[model samples]
Target: MAALSISLSAQNVTGLQGEAKNNLLRLTWVDSVDARGPVYIYRSVSPFEPGTDLSILGRLIKVPYGVQSYIDEVEFPGTWYYFVAASDTEGQRFELPLPPDNSIGIEILESSDRLAVSPAAPPAEIAHGGEPGVNSLSAAVEGDSVIVTFRAEDRGRAVVLYRSARPLKQARDLVGAVIVQPDIASPFIDYPVPGIPYYYAVIFEDDLTRGTAALYPGRNATVEAVEVPQGSDGVGLSSSASIRSLPLPMISLAAAVPGMNAFDETPSPVELSPEASKALEDLEPVQRKSSLAKSPRAFSQDLEAPGGGEEYALYSIMQDFFLKKDWDGCRNALAGYLGLPRSSASEARARFYLGQCYYFLGQPRESLFEFLSAQPAYPDESAEWIQASLAALVK
Candidate 1:
């Protein structure tokens, strides 16, 4: 009888190398000699040990035979280790370099570094069958919230996920949040614990495939509670209820001037000297009103005084803007006033005007947000405005 001889075929992936462009890593390699099996890619932050189970190494991608490259959009800036393995048609798996070789490595630097070395590259376009492509992602700390903005190619849906730490391994590791849709621009407000950092990522999914991108890394960003400036009046209103119950009278053109209905007639823009303009510019509208309270010449006596002397002046200005139907001017002044530290009553009034301004501007969402923010300052007074905003939103 002739001796039977059998030989095992070699299935090895070779020539692995990576290049870092911005936060994205592009990996390339030569296909295995036995091109009959699928290739699996694995990644880790630390070096892989000998005999490490390819199954447990956090599989990043699986490609059919003949595909030689993959692009990974890394979430955090650091070094990453990667390796590839191939499985034969018979289901026999073999690591690329067998037992003694080290995994390929790539170092992702900070965004600033990438910006310095090259013109900052636009985010890599992730293809998701007819889904809108996100062009950019940015976050800014505003008062106590993180405002995240996403600019996309077309209007579509996206799911946001966030974590407090680095190296986001998988989608399951993140806490899912808002589902954003197409708008002029998509903005999501994340109310995180003050002083804690956060990292955000968004996933755009379609029927065929899903694309993921990092929104914010929270490296130098953090939420900080803003301190409201003290008002001229010593007393401050605590809650929205207190503001609504206050005896402050609403200013209307009918009450501001005798025999002259503001709505019936337009008021000329008030002329100001360069000195007065400069002075007013330096102070918030609320603070400016406080300054005016010291001078009786700033306002007419016919306007009823509400709350403190300062509020009387503010109401006078607000009434003038409203009577003239100058929505833009009214909105700007109201924004300045609301940004200052104020009694709840003052905040409530500012929010009301701001909400109305937004409504007139055809921005129902902003109108609703202002009305809701005012709720904590004056629940009763804001209820009507809130209802109006909600109605506009429904329309």
Candidate 2:
């Protein structure tokens, strides 16, 4: 009899799980020899030992020759044995990698599929969706009940409530007990024991594919809980809910005034003094420009082209160095600045900072490398300033 060559293959399954469910089994293979017909598939009732007779529960017949796939949905969740063999026109048989003599059945490890969560579940009666809108919870002066109002304009995942004693401290979860979405008015009422100052935040969980997401999108409000006054009869009117603005402050005109400012009245810019300006100018140009000036967001905006449309990549790196106070980060950002496309003048300024970063790192030789790179790139007047610095370094 002539020999028939054979091979077998397998692969890990992916995208087979969602929410809390799993679906479909996927496999891959390579390097097979003269495969013909649909690869036959079978499930064994029990684990088959090597060289043991096993029951053939089913077969995936007529598998096209050289085909590397066989998806069997007939099998249920349990261990099952599988074997593939090729039969020639003359009835000659060749088994791929020969099954472990009657080995344990192929493990059909299955998991349940997660039921579809209605992006609209909690009912229109309590439905909340899109991003969380205004979140306001205030206690009525006459009664013990507190009012909680919010708008869920966009459909999202679950909405949760957290309460903190201190502003922005770690919060304790207070989500379901108060109220859920699909509610009538924007604010609902919750009765709490009196005499504790409470800070509340409503978190709208994003429809997250990955782990990264902003837990809470809108502004958080704080209110202290107080005992209902002894004799008041009428229910206190709740304050009108306002749209919560972005948590991070921006330099746009809308952010300047409170009621007048388009965003909300926060504050105005404090003018820098002449002396402060000159002190800032003493640093390299990039340093002077990169330092925190007004709001962090505004400062970040100024790093790129005027009016801050696209962010300069180098500025982002530099900001990390400034915030982290990491010398190594400064060095990395300095190198990145050098690699940026810029006019020769800008290059000279960037090189000067490269030297400064090295000096900060206590590497005078490496600092000299950057200073040398800057000398020819800068004008004589600028180069002279660097020359004077060399004398200071020696001294």
Candidate 3:
């Protein structure tokens, strides 16, 4: 008799199992199969919709040719379902059905989900002198500057103090103080060295009565500590402390009157460093023309006005990054540019470029959001691009 021949089809994955611990779901499967192709894993919060393509279930992973395990760290509390499919070298895929070993689902219960709802806290009592004072004071290090911002409950004169070291329990620890009128929208920008960190405190005085209160990192002062010095008229005062050995630099408060105690006078303009000045320039809102220019001559006439230095720098950096196809660098630069307050046209342009960068980085969701934000600012220019991107993503 002639020799008999037999062949076997690619086997479906077997012995699949899963266990849930806290917010982690661990899955494992037997590797005894002789299949030689990639194994794809899919997950969903609910069972796949009827007639749903397996590719659209949101691929959780693609295990190597021989690997047979996966772990998912869920970010929220919920029940989740999972499935696995094995593909042969010839592009044939065999999906494994739910295992009899209870390995198809995982339930995560976060601590927050288990807690009972508590009653809301009572409203805070108003401060004396009709002064609501300042609250939600925050400080952050951005680049080489420390930006401080706070919400004022009442109109008042505010001062921000900076120190190199922490434990700023007393006013004497404050090395430099600057006056900031609460009427303005500008934030206090303290320029420090590149690598050093600093602490900050704020004091607000009522414009009518000089009742003073201080605000620290996490808490507000219940009692006023600043008192008007005897035998001196009510004038704005500058306070300072010394730090000889630290690498920090001292900011001058020469315009502040000494031994004065009053919030009557207008605060002196804050002198900004070169970098801060550039940043502020970049943030200045641009005024748009009431009507579009009709001809090339009109456009040329409009261009006669001088442009800001920082704005030019920002544009140059963006162009360079885009031309070089450096997606990450372009994204970061665009983000920094957007952080500064910008005009409507500038904001729209920056957002559009940022959306392009996100798309090139393989993040379609973020790109879609950015495109939507840019659409409102420049509808005529952004409508076509936004529609095309949305259509492609939907398909």
Candidate 4:
């Protein structure tokens, strides 16, 4: 008998993807033939920090070799980041670069309480392939829908189309655009809010899997705001029927994605403010906080109301701090607010305020993170803040 020798070089799962349907989170990836055995999956609230052990995420799943997809029954509805890596026969795993490679993130919305959170069967299957490289991407008005046509480097790969009010600069701009179709065939036809112009961008499943699908605006990524004439869109369907029959969004331009960049998920590294630079002269990077609060702020509105609960109570405390312009107090309260087991209607408000606190206190970088996190809950309300925070950080 001979021993199996596996090379421990840099390897990654190409085409990693995640989609949220109701309460189900489906993840799928390409299994490179070079893999030795099992695969490891990890999830986190924020982007996965480099070099951190997978176990620390507190939710690690190991799928046996040959399994290309897994469905997770998620408990809460909020933002979730995920990454997958192939493991060796003995379970040795190598660290791969985050997002755009073996990593993808999606924000889940609260589903009906009666609708069980049990994982549904794996999604139709991640149709992945094609060169992923794209060219001649353009948008044209088609009756009631906008037809986004582009030449894919190769065909058969699933594409994610985005609609934005402004031109997208890169794939990162995706956070600011509405995902018209997460997994669809090319020549994407979208039923957007009638009467407004939009830009569109197309990204491939293969690019997402290989982390090479980074957006290049006109060259590769960025497009949105598909304005169509106000009238009938689908075949033999009235305007109202067209809006209701399609699974794609028919939301107002402002609702689809706030002002301009409310959901800019990944911003460049933030430079320390002069005062912050001095304050961090020797401080170690453990975790940043403002200060501790004595108690949860009293709830406003009726306690028996649908929106009133522990989540609301905690949010109130943060609001009180925000009202007094107490950035640190608000930040400290946010520490507890985010720990709640489930998300609430106030989820967007809480994050929006925290984003403001960071922005007013000269922490635009942190502000961007909070605003982006808040998008799933309150898509239309936070873009202005995202724009301001981004402008500040960029300067």
- Per-residue lDDT of candidate 1, residues 47-128 (tens digit): 4545666564445577777888888886665456677777788766666333212246565655444511111111232111
* Model 1, CA-based lDDT: 0.52
Best by lDDT: 4
lDDT of 1 at 250: 62
RMSD of each: 24.1, 26.0, 27.7, 25.3
Model 2 lDDT, residue 87, Cα: 48
Give the whole-model CA lDDT for all candidates, comma-separated.
0.52, 0.40, 0.50, 0.61
Candidate 4 overall lDDT versus native? 0.61
Give one digit per residue, the lDDT tens place, for model 2 in 240-345: 4222212355576554444454655555566799999999989765633543222111133325544331235545554667445576887787676667577675
TM-score, candidate number 1: 0.30
Ranking by lDDT: 4, 1, 3, 2
lDDT-wise, the better of 1 and 3 is 1
Best by TM-score: 1
Candidate 3's TM-score reads 0.25
Model 3 misplaced stretches (Cα beyond 4 Å)? 1-10, 32-34, 48-52, 99-103, 112-395
What clash count goes with each model? 2, 29, 0, 17
Q: What local lDDT does model 2 show for residue 118? A: 19
